[model samples]
Target: MDDDIRRGDLVAEGEPEQEFNPGIAARLPRKTVAGGALVRDEAGRILFLEPTYKPTLDIPGGIAEYDESPYEACVREVQEEIGLALPIGPLLVVDWVPALGVWSDALAFVFDGGILDQPTIDRLVLDPSEARAHYFLTLEEAAPRLRPSMARRLARALQALTTSRPTYTDFGR
Candidate 1:
């Protein structure tokens, strides 16, 4: 191999060298991305979903698919999980959840789902394949039933709602 021929560089034997930016292929921090919603009821209670596969309750959202944005994923997940097509609002919380050795670290975005009326809530059809049921509970009542990280994210997202600004947290702290 010629000294001019570096690894990852493409060239024909008699053709001029072609340049490629190595940085373009630089590795980025490995983190899974997820999106969630902070839906509320008319009486100021948060809505939670009980997934069939998880012990703890969860918000209505899921892992973003390839080429999907967090907001888009949030909307899709809400419809898929709860049959709600309500427009998702601005971001409320951007949380970085640390890995628990069982999975990769994740960056989660929780968007404001606005408020739902009793009729709308009653109309919700929970997708049994993904979730068993849904409940509207005050944060205090929800803490024990939710993942600790999720409880923290809820607190942060509520604060964001009150302040009308986005909040950031690490490991849901």
Candidate 2:
């Protein structure tokens, strides 16, 4: 099992801590579920979507329907956002947030997706209600521009995928 730590838990540079605070935790509201994809192109660039209602860029995904699994939600989200059907691989990260009083228990599935051999990203068929544009970026190029949470999440996901070890972690809980 992965180590669990509370928000305020502190550790020295060389020490490892595993205990976590279970209290002060925000419970899930009916356990909201969602999924996203870490879609990479032939040139190793990752895809990101700029949300219409939000300034931060995000992965393409939406809440999963009651009958849908996380994987199913991911496939559906990609099709809805980009009008493309691509194969999804293993789960990379499962993130949890509680401070916002919102439980975005998300599963990120990695995939060898994106327009094949296309150097330029075409305009996306984004849902105006959800996103305004889509773009591709290398990890280094996108790091500085993404929200801190998104950048950290992506880094964790990429590490998990490369190491073949899936990770599940809670935040603000």
lDDT (10s digit) by residue, model 1, range 1-173: 23355333444545754547655444656678999999999999998999999899999999999867788889899999999898899999999988887888999999999999989998899999999989999999999998888899999999999899998999789
**Segments of candidate 2 deviating more than 4 angstroms:** 1-29, 101-116, 119-124
Instruction: Show where candidate 1 strays beyond 4 Å.
Output: 1-29
Question: Which model scores highest in TM-score?
Answer: 1
Tell me each candidate's TM-score. Answer: 0.84, 0.68
lDDT of 2: 0.67
Q: Model 1, poorest ten-residue lDDT window?
A: 1-10
Best by lDDT: 1
**lDDT tens digits by residue: candidate 2, 134-165:** 77787678877676666777777778767988
Q: What is the C-alpha lDDT of each candidate?
A: 0.89, 0.67
